[model samples]
Target: MPGPSPHLPSGPRTLPGEGRTAVVTGASSGIGAATATRLAAEGFDVVLGARRLDRLTTLADSIGARALPLDVTDEASVAAFTGALDRVDVLVNNAGGAFDARPVAEADLDSWARTYEVNVLGTVRLTAALLPALRASGAGDVLFVGSTAGLVSYEGGASYTAAKHGVHTLAETLRLELVGEPVRVIEIAPGMVRTDEFSLNRLGSAEAADAVYRGVREPLVAEDVADCIAWALTRPHHVNVDLLVVRPRAQAAQHKVHRE
Candidate 1:
């Protein structure tokens, strides 16, 4: 991406999030939490949803937003979460994670199943439920917090990479399906984001997680990705930022990361 040109508008003349409700899934921690906070600051009536109600509620209270229990993998949970919402102007599909790093030869079918369940199926479920409310908003935004892994393949990353690729295409197909609707489908794909629980949860150990970013001086953090999300969303309604791929300076590509 290139730097903003002087000819472009300095900022949105009207606040897009004002007087509107935004729902953020996976809001209990990491990029999800950061995004929820950023959206709240942007003047959206933000709703935080995750399985961990305690952390979700705490974060919501601190940010002046609402918290609700949500397990996107569970049909009942998703149904309940969507039923509770009265209105939705923005749907931030950030409730996904990578579960393993293994080659196809040593594939763990269960892990692959879990990864797809959360990343692809779960996202589709929640988005489908909220499409009506978003359409009714007159100006709606559907933002997918995707990953650079979605765009590029790598060794020992079949499960995660495949799932994220589904997300990438999902965003593409959605944009085509709703061409003239008063809604925007946006996807934020971040690379080398060093969040607290993302690697830890995937690798199943703290030391293993630390090693993932050990040599990097400044890997992208949760807040960095969150900033990109909020920036893309706060743009003028007509200015549809279809996809934004953000990565730290040290990371040039999935296979190329400067580690000094």
Candidate 2:
């Protein structure tokens, strides 16, 4: 969906990720896709996994990364993806998104279920499956692409906020539990990112999507968050960036945004 990526390092990326293997979920588009491409370009043997095999394959081909079909909500799918991988030096859990923007009183149970499945349970499944390989790596990195919604809630965001809060807690608890392990757990919470499909998918209308970023001078792009993810991983093994919150300059917080 993106134009030719100039961000990728030039030349043939022959094992550019070196021997380090990285797996990214929801990599068919947006943040996940960008993160997979960024990681691959950074010399990490990246595996692009998502439910959409066609798009995954396309991106994989473009970046010379492996493409695998993955649905984080399904245990079998996650198992199959992780089973196919022998080593996982880095795992980017980016498979989740907001479903609806309604108050709790009007929330749809089904939508909430879907949100939790992809955001919380899905992360649990994938991370659990890959923990062994990560531990073996002695410097494994696990990154979660969370959202500002995870940290603060707003009106018409009941289900999404709750789900992301679960993700934030999951990252915190996992880090403490893995204190002695070699694996590092990191969470990147981005705000007001205008991806091709994120707002459109959430609002289900071109006009609604446009309104989400209306009057904003500049919003965070997928590459901005990908840059953060790639940077955190490349750091010395000793440093574990517990949480990194990123927002567009116009967005001071979930409740505060500077609209022109």
Candidate 3:
């Protein structure tokens, strides 16, 4: 064999996310917090953002990251958050949540609007505000934390499903629009994740949220989803993970789950 071919390609000289700045929203709890922690350990200069300044500050100090107040649904908040950032190599849009679980026939229009405001409109606003900074980075990444609800609908989840569907499409459209750019657009969609506040916030009670996972032997936790996100972001610059859907072994589909 020829001793090391001169024409062969070499591996990356530096680790992915090394010496880069990553901004994570909705980072007060759940997947957002877990992702911020993981990314910080991976060598990125992480910035945690959420409306809860107290929680954000605690988490940031623990991980040696910076914490900033951000309310994605508020235009003023988005402007202020983006204005305070000096560099943004990675933008993790993780601020959205499900407010209610009701069927279309009994739909709460207010809840629907709130859902759309945070999941769809908020993501658009922040991404638009940071586009210039991302473009300037030369090797930027935009990652959306979406949901499996975006892929399939379930009973009593019209508002959340619809909003996540919008997120799915937004990621698709942006990727298409930025085809020739150096930016990498990625989306991580998780199924049946059992977090501290997600289910309780949507279902409206501790017991109600517990009932959602009563018999399930194993359901995904926030760290599980965060692991998937870290892996996707650490890939080679040219390798864009368009969409990564991760679910627990107990969950096979949106309508199907293995129970005790």
Q: Report lDDT (CA) for all predictions.
A: 0.94, 0.90, 0.94
- Stretches of model 2 off by over 4 angstroms after superposition: 1-17
Q: Lowest summed-lDDT stretch of 10 residues in model 2?
A: 8-17
Residue pairs in clash, model 2: 16-43, 17-43, 17-44
RMSD from true fold, candidate 2: 6.6
**Residue-wise C-alpha lDDT for candidate 2, range 65-170, written one tens digit per residue:** 9999999988899888888998889999999988788788898999999989889999999999899999999889888888889999899988889999999999
Task: Please give me the total number of clashing residue pairs in predicted model 2.
Answer: 3
lDDT of 2: 0.90
**lDDT of candidate 1 over 1-260, digit per residue (tens):** 98899898877675557898999999999999999999888888999999999999999999999999999999999999999999999999999998999999999999999999999999999999999999999999999999999999999899999999999999999999999999999999999999989999899999999998988989999999999999988888999998899999988999988877
Deviation (Å) of 5 in candidate 3? 22
Give lDDT tens digits, candidate 3, residues 90-188.
999999999998889999999999999999999999999998899899989999999999989989999999999999999999999999998999999
For candidate 3, the 10 contiguous residues with the lowest summed lDDT are 8-17
Of candidates 3 and 2, the better by lDDT: 3
Winner of 2 and 3 under TM-score: 3
The TM-scores of all predictions, comma-separated, are 0.94, 0.93, 0.94
